[model samples]
Target chain A: MNPQFIMDGLVAGAMIGLGAIGVTLTYSILRFANFAHGEFLSWGAYLALAVSGALGFLATGLTRPIAPFSFGWSLPLALVIAIFLTGLLALVLDAVLFARLRSRGSAVIILVMASFGASLALRSLLEFLFTSKPAYYTKALQIAVRLGGGLRATPDQLLSLGVTVVVVVVIHLLLTRTEIGRSMRAVSENPALAGIAGIDVRRVIRFVWFIGAGLACIAGTMTGLLVQIRPYLGHDLLLPLFSAAILGGIGSVPGAMIAGLIVGLSEAGAVQLVGAEWRSAVSFVILVLVLLLRPRGLFGRPA
Target chain B: MTGASPIPAAGAPALETRGLVAGYEPDLPIVRGVDLSVASGELLVLLGPNGAGKSTLVKAIAGVVPIHAGTVSIGGRDITALPAHRKIGAGLAFVPQTENIFATLSIQENLQIAAAVLPKARRAERIAAMYAQFPDLAVKPARLAGSLSGGQRQMLAIARALMVDPPVLILDEPSAGLSPKIVADVFSMLTEINRAGVTVVLVEQNVKAALAIASRAIILVEGRIGHEGAAQDLLDDPILARLYLGTGQAMEARRP
Candidate 1:
């Protein structure tokens, strides 16, 4: 009967939804579930933190709060740099790891296993760089704003939801309207055919890595802002990310977003009802049930 | 080429390859040392037994397969070093044997991706041209290509290839899985395309249907051209039997 669960669910859902877009896209185009995708979130969050810390030191005025928002101009600027750096990281990872494997005609299983290795390497590197200590974007406190029906959310939380909507809508339009986005879909559909049709397969791959990791960066920044950042932050959410991606269907952007919310709600509801220990089980249960009943998922054919 | 008329390079073969050897791996050359020339505005059908490199030869020419050694030219343009994506701009278009269309995409999306290589102003006009040619697709541009009938899928694939109005269009096994009536429709469509001055190189298993519309035919055996002549000259029993059964030369070479 508590409305607190709704707020918790939505905030987590937005983060998971954004993260799941990267997972689904890598899986669809690259033909592998990139376990390293989760590490991008950790790297992104830490990168933004490092940049914000430096920027705040350079120009103390940047740290001033942007109205009701907890963080200010520094954080936004840091997010931009973090997105670019994260995107570059994704591309380098693919070039050094995945692209080499593809050239050698590696099997999907090998690619998946290689991604597991990448995930470990990335996470270990992140831990060594930033340590395992929990970090936050801001220490400023926020009071919850009230809405109708006993609902309440912080300005940051509302921003997260609004941003997710904008990201999803923009991505949808890109896929449908833009030449590059349509080429991405074309490559995902039939890579060889896309190449023969005059689509630069490598360029599409680069774009995917950039876009996928950029989205991951946004999700990571939001997570750091909302909760506390830890080395295992993305690791902890891996299951929910995969669940949201698969439950929404493999390649559908809107599906992943909606599915993220569903997974978030389920986990939140489960934590409230059966204690937090059962929260992880919620996503797994939903994944199993969906695969059992609707194998293609809500939007499996892709957008 | 999409907005303006297609003009084949005068006095140049539509597509040409010399000393071509290609396959998935560098050491295993499925298409070995093929010297081929297709004249402008010709419908040349490639016929061969299984593993004779019929598909591999076309794929190598298209830059889809890894070439161990080769030179491929389109309308006198040297495109041997070009990547597969750039070949379309060089006046050569290739439609793969399978997975030819973007199955998850709508008919319009598939055409749009094909036309993406065209100029912005010419893209819509090219797509409209495709729709005009293939009425089956025009009726439902928004429909998913995967759900289309086998015949319709082939039409869409051909249409996608024609979107750029390439001087040379190479198709690998365009008649592999289609029904007889559908095969006729596809062959007739190719004939129409060839008549419009597009050079077509089709690899086909349906010998009778393919030769019906083709002007010339080449039979490949063990990665080498074993026979070449007028299309009508190939319909005889000896050639058709040679198509299904390999030349005894390979067996003789294998004997200790």
Candidate 2:
């Protein structure tokens, strides 16, 4: 069997893990399954794409590729802007839809349904504006670096994995060492207790959206770099993102990362063992098994 | 605990409520118009039969329940409209009956989160103070609060509320699931806290034990104050036992 599948899975798992942090966080704190979260990934990719294109339009040299990587400084610069915009988009959705519904004390099912509607609207908007045609970060191709053992990967893929580790470590420290991080955990555990303990529950909710969306932006940018960017890029990843999050356990950062890798490796193995057509079913199978065996996921505390 | 006064000053009631009406819904209020006053450094127990609104009254004052009309104040400052979270900053701390601790979080984390309202530089010192008060929690700061024994959990909940050093402390049924000995330990702790200048208000089902440590008691019957007096007086009042305490037959049977 080709060991190349391992690299491919790790790279894909890194992206899925990064994206699932947002899902686990939102679910843990807001207590809802936000179907629209996948849309944030699509939005992040497109927003960065548009910003990168704009930079190139202004100055051609700005788009020049960095020596080892596929994209230029402009793509990284665009990534920052895209992150901010995606976070803003999350807040906008919360303000217009989720926040109002929450204030009125809406049911969890209603919030989930609302997120589905939001997801549809977001995906449709991307399709209408950018069309369903797949886009590329750079058409230029580079030689894969050989790391022996018949294993190889592009610089872009390596960079994605590195960035994910840094992000996960940073998030781990934030949740464990920082005050805001503890507040998020406290709110996720018991919101009423949090409020009485003097935590501003509303502020924590807003912060969750902002940071969760920012994390999703990084994942989207990574996906766009590794694969083709399409309106349904995030749509296709919804199941896998959820699988990683639940498998890792809700509200657990490290769990999401490990679960993401497991899902990714399993899918890649499925592609090798079976056919590529059955790749998507891997996440479904894992999710079903988890629901049957361990509904709390890997790290979630039993309810 | 900084800009706002964290303790009531001289001549001002530690906590006061005028015409409080509160519940989950705006139209359906569980706590009817209940005007109550708790003086500084007082240990007061709220007792009642089932559905008497004892919990609701304190919850309303603590800002957990929706107050339709009322004025709650600490240190002569009006805080009725203030959100539940801000009340801690205004010298009021509340501990709910159930789910008071973040079970998934470590004991240190639970205490640290409660102390977030304090200045960053002061947080460690304050947490140290709490550790000194409850050596059991200090023994295992890294332990998950959910794994704590019932008595230890109650202590941790009180410690969390006391983290902010608020002047007025309120709790709802803290002894609900605890044994009688643990209940006594908790009540004695409350008495000590009250003696140290914090006003204490408790909603207790362990009426006899609560009276032992309480300086005063207020019995509620259907969202209104049915009776109130000195704690010692209420304990011996046979009429109070027969009418509202629900232990009339037991008291009569035990009598010589």
Candidate 3:
């Protein structure tokens, strides 16, 4: 029972939780599991890379680290742009591809297949542009700060947790207090009824894509900050992302986050018991067990 | 309400469908050549047996079913080609027969979603007003709509449509599957809503109960208008009841 394993799990869980929110949301509203969602994370990391490279000189002072931090203001600025670009990419993909299939009343399997095809195309393009090698945001490394319980974490890991909290709070406010948020929930429950209620179903869908993609972007940025950014940054997290979403109960935001923590802790614990090579298999095992035990997930309604 | 004059001879009809031809499939028309009009403040009850296309006709008017040929106008504004989501903007609200409310959302959230089309400033006021109108819903605002009893769900469905405060309200089988007492209460609620100045178009199978509160009634048989006249007049003619609903004996036995 190494305390460091639990701390590492918390850091990794924040990233997966952020990514799972979009997966759960898309599955709930669109009624299909989008395999291409992971590509948005990859795209976010690369977009930030490109933006920071192009605009690094303009914010040379901001790019320099202030203190205990490794990366600086430039990465944050790039993150904002990356979030917008990734969200726009998602909207374009939906408008050009998914929307057509949906309007024609394509089956859910078809949408899922289209997503697989999309995932391949996106991953290929990303690798072609950025190469297969890993990229880092900053060359400097920060020392891990020790906590009282024999646990240690880098400053970036702690900062990632803080950002996750802020984002989750913002999403909470949006979902509970805003009109569009209520409309989104209504559409997920019954799209036809939502339409009859005077809600613009298409508009609500577009907004969902924006929020879902934007959050995925932030998750990708955090993952890249924690580990090195690579073309398969999203690919590597895909299993964990989906497992978190299903385990949390599809369509439940807070559920996904909690499931994310559980999945992360399990994977971290599995690595200590088995080996690092078996970490990826942990998500599959947990997902299978949960499905067999409770197909609707912890908080999901009965099917 | 029995002898309310047809069309009022006043402002434009609250809702009008001319030469309406529609169906789920392109070639097979479920409803065709249906021309109907309802005036302001009128309770027009539509009645028919199974496969009579009663629900289809109502859905076509509400813009749920696709219209192949014809025009649907509300307040003289042509809205024939408008999608279901846009019909509410044309001063109309529709309540479908099944899955009529957001089952998982809280009762209050159901009303809030309906009020999304209005300006943000008035949403709270409108929601508060709906609570006042449907006191049963007001008591348990936090309950999931799906958990509600059949009668309560029906009330919530109607209240959801009324959230938009449309001039024309169309409901398909609002009394379907409800207990007899609840059905009576729902019909009275419809009449009450109609008297409050919202024109109502009800598609119902409960002919006797529906006709009681209806100002006008139209009977559909096999996708065409079989009978059209005042509600009391239709109820009085025993032969028409037999031809239209096949319940002539029961309807005649109840006649005073």
lDDT of 2 by residue, B134-201 (tens): 99999989999999999999999999999988888999999999998998898888988888888899
Q: How do the residues A159-243 of candidate 1 rate in per-residue lDDT, one tens digit apiece?
A: 9899989999999899888888888888888888888988999999999999999999999989989888888888888899999
On the 0 to 100 scale, the lDDT of residue A66 in model 3 is 51
- Consecutive 10-residue window with the lowest summed lDDT within model 2 chain B: B247-256
Higher-ranked by DockQ: 2 or 3: 2
Complex DockQ per candidate: 0.82, 0.83, 0.73
| Higher-ranked by TM-score: 1 or 2 | 2
| TM-score for predicted model 2 compared with the true structure | 0.97
Residues B1-256, candidate 3: write the lDDT tens digits: 2211122234888889898888888698888788888888889999876777888888888777778888988877788878888888777889999999888889988888787777788789888888998899999899999999999999999998888678888999998999999999999999899998989999998888999999999988777887899999998987888877666454322211
Categorize the docking of model 3. medium
Candidate order, DockQ descending:
2, 1, 3
Candidate 2 clashing pairs, residues 3+ apart or interchain = none
Candidate 2: tens digits of C-alpha lDDT, residues A189-299 = 888889999999999999999999999989998998899899998989999999999999999999999999999999999999998999999999999999999999999
Candidate 1 chain A: worst-modelled 10 consecutive residues by lDDT = A294-303
lDDT of 3: 0.87
Q: B128-221 in candidate 1: lDDT tens per residue?
A: 9899999999998999999999899999999998998888888998887888888888888889888888888999877778888999999888
Top candidate on lDDT is 2
